[model samples]
Target: MGMLNTLLQAVSSAPIGGAIGAGIAAIGAGIGIGMIGKSACESIARQPEAASDIRGSMILTAAFIEGVCLFAVIAGLLAVLK
Candidate 1:
């Protein structure tokens, strides 16, 4: 238990921890966006006539994912600064 606590403290105290967390979060967001784009492309290829609708949905989903990632970065910054 003591060792675990020490490890936790060390991680929380590291100067680059927050930045690393933010970077990881951004990576996740990027992956999500990539997947969305891939799916959208596949969908359009399968049904060319529905390209517009697929694009619209993909844009909306990407925007939402970006928003969440932005919020997480802000929160991480705030926590680190505090």
Candidate 2:
């Protein structure tokens, strides 16, 4: 019974941890997207003729990163609400 109570207390106090996780996920996503944009721009500058191709691939990669970050945030919300 004592262990059970302790577990419950821990769970109840986990919202802070969940919020931190979400924040970290957001930061990571921002960094990832920024890097992609930076590299794409550099590539385009080096080869203006291939700008179209570089832009297309950059957009796709950024979208994927955003999706993963979204999932992570949702998971964090679930943890906080649990």
Candidate 3:
């Protein structure tokens, strides 16, 4: 029981979880952005006339994802620091 409690305490006190979460969030955002860009390019290729609109929408969506990722990173950092 004593050893178990010590192990639990050590695990709970470490900031590894927060760091891992932050890293995951960043990676997820990168993948999401990449997908958006890829799909936008494909759409543009299929409809060259709508390339401008597709590019604009893709940029907007990527910005939104980036904003959310930024917030996630900040929250994770706070958790680790606190």
CA lDDT for candidate 2: 0.95
**Where in model 3 is the C-alpha error above 4 Å?**
1-14
Model 2 lDDT tens row, 1-82: 9999999999887997888899999999999999999999999999999999999999999999999999999988988888
Q: Any residue pairs clashing in model 3, and if so which?
A: none
The pairs that clash in candidate 2 are none
Worst 10 residues of 1 by lDDT: 11-20
Per-residue alpha-carbon lDDT of candidate 3 for residues 1-82, written as tens digits (9 for 90 to 100): 9999999988787677778888999999999999999999899999999999999999999999999999989888987897
Error of 1 at 11 (Å): 8.8
Q: Against the unseen true structure, what C-alpha lDDT does each candidate score?
A: 0.90, 0.95, 0.92
**Which portions of model 2 show Cα errors greater than 4 Å?**
none
Tens-digit per-residue lDDT, 1-82, candidate 1: 9999999988778646777787888999999999999999999999999999999999999999999999888777776776
Q: Model 1 scores what on Cα lDDT?
A: 0.90
- Sorting all predicted structures by TM-score, with the top scorer first, yields 2, 3, 1
